[model samples]
Target: MKKRNTCLICLQGLSGSGKTTVANFLASTLNIPVYHSDVERKKLFGLSPTENSSLANLDIYTKEATIRTFQKLYELAFEELSAQQSVLVDAAFLRHHERLRMQQLARDTGALFLIVKCQAGQQIMIDRIRTRQHLGNDPSEASEDLIHKQKQWQEALTSDELQTCIKVFTEEKNWQETLLQRIYRYIS
Candidate 1:
C-alpha cells in the first residue's frame, strides 16, 4: 500500500473568534474529518450539539471538563491519524499547554501539524456570540461575558509555533478562500 500523507490542523482562538467556522470550512473543502470541542463536550453529557447545555445541571466548562474534552479530541484525532487520514480540531486553546498537547500528538503520529489562529476584533467576537445565542444553532454556548474573559486568558502563539501557523482573519469577507489558499500553499 502507498503511504498516505496526513496533517493535524488545530484551530484555536477566543470564543466567537470563528475558529469553528474555519474548521468546518476546511474540513468540508479538504474532505477531512473534524473534531470539535464544543460538540464533543456536550456529547460527553449525552446532550445534542445544539441543545442547551446550560440546562443540563452540569458545568461542562469547568477545568476538569475542559481537560477531558481536549483529551477526547486528541483521541479522536489519533484514531484518524492512525488510519492515515488528515483531521481538523476546533477549540479555544486559551492556554499554552493546551496547544502543546496537540503539537505533541502530531509529532507522535508523524503527521504534519499546523495551527490556524482565527482572529477577530473584540467587538466582532461579542457580536458573533450574541447572534449565535439568539439563533441557538451552534454547539458553542459562549456568551458575551465569556468573550471578555477569553480575551484575558488567550495566549499568543510563540515564535516557534508561528513557523507552522497561519493567522486567519475570520472577519474578512473572503477569509475561507484565503485560508484555503494558504493551507494549500503550506502543504504543497
Candidate 2:
C-alpha cells in the first residue's frame, strides 16, 4: 500500500462560520493533527482573547503582529509537513495573499492543498457568535466589531476562489452528512 502524502487542509471562513468545528471533526476523522492559527498566535505572543480583540481594533501595528504570527504558523506547519504528517489548519485566512502563500508552500513541499470554505447565513452566523460569546467558550479571537468586519470581508470573496475550493457546507443541507461525504471523498 502506498503511503498518503502530507495534506495541508485549510479551513477558511468568517467568524461563526463553523470552520473550527468542521476542521476539528475532519482532523479527528482523518486522524491528522490540527493546527489552529489563533491558538498558535496566542501561544507565541501571549495574546489573550481580550488582547487579540484590542489588536484587531488597532489600525497599523496590528498588521505587523499578524504577519509575524502567520510567519510563525507557516514555519511550524512546514516543519510538521516535512515529517510527512498530515495537518489541518483552522484559520479565518481572510486575505487573498495569505491563501496564495499557502498554495505556494503546498506546491513547494509537494503536499496536497485542500481549501475548505465554510459558509452560513448571515443571521445564523450572528446568532452563533452571540451564543458563543455568551457561553464564553469561543476560541476565536473576534469581538463583536471583528465579527462585523469579518462578515463584510466574506461578502467580498471572489467567485473564482469559491469555485476552486471544496465547500463542505452548513447552510441549507444537513451539515453532518455533507461533512461526512467530504471526508469520505478526501480519504478515498
Candidate 3:
C-alpha cells in the first residue's frame, strides 16, 4: 500500500524568535524530522574553532551562496517528502524572496507549505537570548550588537509580507502555549 505524502512546515523567523523551539515541539509531536540549517551545516561541514569560519564568512557573499544552500536543502527535503516523510525546516528566512522560493518548492513538490513567522517583544527576545547564552545553548550566537543590527533590518520589512505571514507575538506570557496552538491549527 502506498503511503500518503506528508506536509512540509517551514518555520521562518528572526534571530531568537523561537523558530527552533517551535520547530522542535512540532516535530516531536508529529513524529517528523526537523531540518535545522545551522545544525545540518555543522554536521555536513564540520565545526571550526574560529568565530568567523568559512561558512560564517560567506554571509557577505551577496546572498548567492545562501540561496544556493537553500535550493539544495529544498531538493533534499523533496526527496524525503517523496518517501512520505514530513519535515520541519527551522531557519531564519528573513527575505521575502526566500519565503517565495519555499512556496514554489512546496507547489512543485505537492507539499503543504505553512509559513510561520514567530515574533516577540523586544525585551522578551533579549531576555531569551541572554538566557540561552548563559546556559551555553544559544543557536543564534547573536550578541547585543547583532541583535541591534537584526532589529534595523526587521524594521525595514514591508507591510505586505508581514500581513501574509503568520505573526506570533511571543512575550513573557504564555508564549509557548500560543505558539503550540498556532502550529497545531496550521498542521491539523
Candidate 4:
C-alpha cells in the first residue's frame, strides 16, 4: 500500500515559491484535498479570492485574524484527517512553531506528518508571482511585497525537522517525483 489512510502534508515556503502549484499537483496525484491558507485568510475577512486583501489591512490580516486563520486551517485539516482523508495545506508557513503545531496535530491523530519545504530561486519566485497576478482571480491575496517580507523573517527549517521533511526545490525538474517517492515511503 502506497497510501496512508491519513497524512498531513504541510507545505512551508515563502510567497511565490510555487507552493500552490505543487500543492495542487500533489493533491491531484495522491488523491488528496488541499486547505489553502491564502484562500482561507481571505474568507476570514468575508472577502472572496479575487478581492483585495493585504497584510497592510489590519482587519483582514491582523494578529488576531492570523491566529484565527491558522486555527481554522488546523480545524479543517484535523477534521479531514480524522475522517481518514489525507490533507495538503497550502501555506507559506514562515514560522517554525506553527509548523510544529501541525506536526503535533498529526501525532495526536495518529497520522503521518510531513513538512515539505518548497524552494526556488528569487527570480523564479518573482516571476511566478507576477504571472499568477497577471492571470487574474488568484486565490492568494498576498502582495508581491510579501515575497520580500517572507525572505526577511522566515525561520528556515532546522536539522531536527529534516527527519520528516522532504525538501523540494521547485525549480528542479525531478522535484515532484522526488517528493512523491519520499512521501510514499512514509504513507505506504
Candidate 5:
C-alpha cells in the first residue's frame, strides 16, 4: 500500500506578518486542519479567542502560558499527524527552540515538516497591526510594541531549518495563490 502524504506545516513569523492569513489560506486550499496558537492559548485559559487576557487579569502571554500554549499546539498537531492527516499551525514561533520542538514532533510522527515564514514590509506590518487593533476582532493581541520587541528577539532559521522552509512576502498581489502553488510543488 502507498503511504499517505501528511505533513505538519508551521506558519511562523513576527506578529502582523500575515501568518494567520497564510495559514487560513493554506488550510482552505489544502483542506487541512489548522491550529492557531493565539486561539488555542485563549482556549486553554477558558476564554474566548478575542477576549482580552489582561482585562481578565490573566496574562496568557506570560512565559509559562507560552510554554503551555505551545505544548497544547504540539499535542493537537500530533493528534492530527498520528491520524494520518495534514495539519497547519499558525504561531509566531519567535524562538528557535520552539521550532526545534515542533520539528521533533514531526519527526516522531513520521510526518513531513515544512515551515512557511510569512513576511511583510515593516511599515505594512505596523499598519496591519494598527488596523487589526482598531477593528478589535482578531484573536492576536499583538501591538506595535510587541512587534518591535519580536523583531529584536525573533530567531532566524538555522541552515537545517532553512532546508524545509519557504518565505512568503505577503504584500504582493496573488500571494496566497502563489504560495499555495509553491507549497504543492514543494511537497510533491
Candidate 6:
C-alpha cells in the first residue's frame, strides 16, 4: 500500500458549536486522533475533562494562559503531523494569528492542513451551551457569559484563511463524510 501524506485538521469555532462532537465523530469514523484543547486545559490544573463548574479555572482564561495552551497544543500537533498521522485539533481558535500559525505549521511540515469551521445559529449555540452546562459531564467550560464575550471579541477568519476552511453547520447536518472525503483529497 502506498503511504499518503498526513493532514492536520483544526476544528475551530465558538463554544457549543459542536466542534467536539464533530471532532469525536471524525476521529472515530476515520480512525484519527482528536486533540481537544479544553481537555488539555483542564489537565493543566490537575482536573478531569469533565470537572464540576465550581472547579472551573475561570482565571486561566486570560490572554497569556490562552496563548500558552494553544502553543503547547500546536507543538504536539507539529509532532504528530510530522510522524504522518492525521490529527484533529478541537478549539475555539478565537485568535486569527493562532490559526495562521497552525496553517504555517502544516505548510512547513509538508502536511495537508484543513480548518473545519463549525458554526451554528446564535440561539442554537446558546441553547447548546445551557444543555451542556446542565449535563455537566462535557469537557467544555464555556458559560453563557463567555459565549457573549466571545461574540464580542472572536476574530473573524481572514479571506486567506477561509480559502482553506470547510464550514460545518452544526445546526443543519452531520458532515463527517464530506469532511473525511475532503481530507482524503489532501492525502491522495
RMSD of each: 1.9, 3.5, 4.3, 2.3, 1.8, 2.1
Score each candidate by Cα lDDT: 0.88, 0.72, 0.65, 0.84, 0.90, 0.82
lDDT per residue (tens digit) for residues 1-188 in model 3: 11344577778766777788877877777788877766554434344322333446544223554565577567767877777776778877776676667767766777766766777766767788788767754445555466677666553335654543565665547766766666565555
Query: How much is the lDDT of residue 25 in candidate 1?
Result: 86
- The residue-by-residue lDDT of candidate 5 on 103-152, one tens digit each, is 99999988889999999998899999999989989998999999879989
- Sliding window of 10 residues with minimal summed lDDT for model 6: 52-61
The sequence of per-residue lDDT tens digits that candidate 4 reaches over residues 50-169 is: 776653354677778889889989999999878878899988788888898999999998888888888999888888888878886788755579888878988878777789888889
Clashing pairs in 2: none
* C-alpha lDDT of residue 121 in model 4: 95
* Stretches of model 2 off by over 4 angstroms after superposition: 47-61, 151-164, 171-173
Candidate 1 residue 36 Cα shift, in angstroms, is 0.8
lDDT of 2 at 184: 55
Write down the TM-score for model 5. 0.96
User: What would you estimate as the lDDT of candidate 1?
Assistant: 0.88
Writing each residue's lDDT as its tens digit, candidate 1 over 18-94 gives 99888888988888999999999999889999988768777888989998999999899999998889899998887
The worst-scoring run of ten residues by lDDT in candidate 5 lies at 1-10
What does the lDDT come to for candidate 5?
A: 0.90
**Order of candidates by TM-score, top first?**
5, 1, 4, 6, 2, 3
For candidate 6, give the lDDT.
Answer: 0.82
Model 6 RMSD in Å is 2.1
Over the stretch 37-152, how does candidate 6's per-residue lDDT look in tens digits? 98887776667889853556356667777877898889889888888777889999878888989999989988777889998888889899899889988878788787788888
Which 10 successive residues of model 4 have the least lDDT summed? 52-61
Q: What are the runs in model 6 whose C-alpha is more than 4 Å off?
A: 56-58
Q: lDDT by residue for model 2 over 34-74, one digit each (tens)?
A: 87776766666565543454545543227776797778768
In candidate 3, which residue ranges exceed 4 Å CA deviation?
1-5, 48-65, 154-164
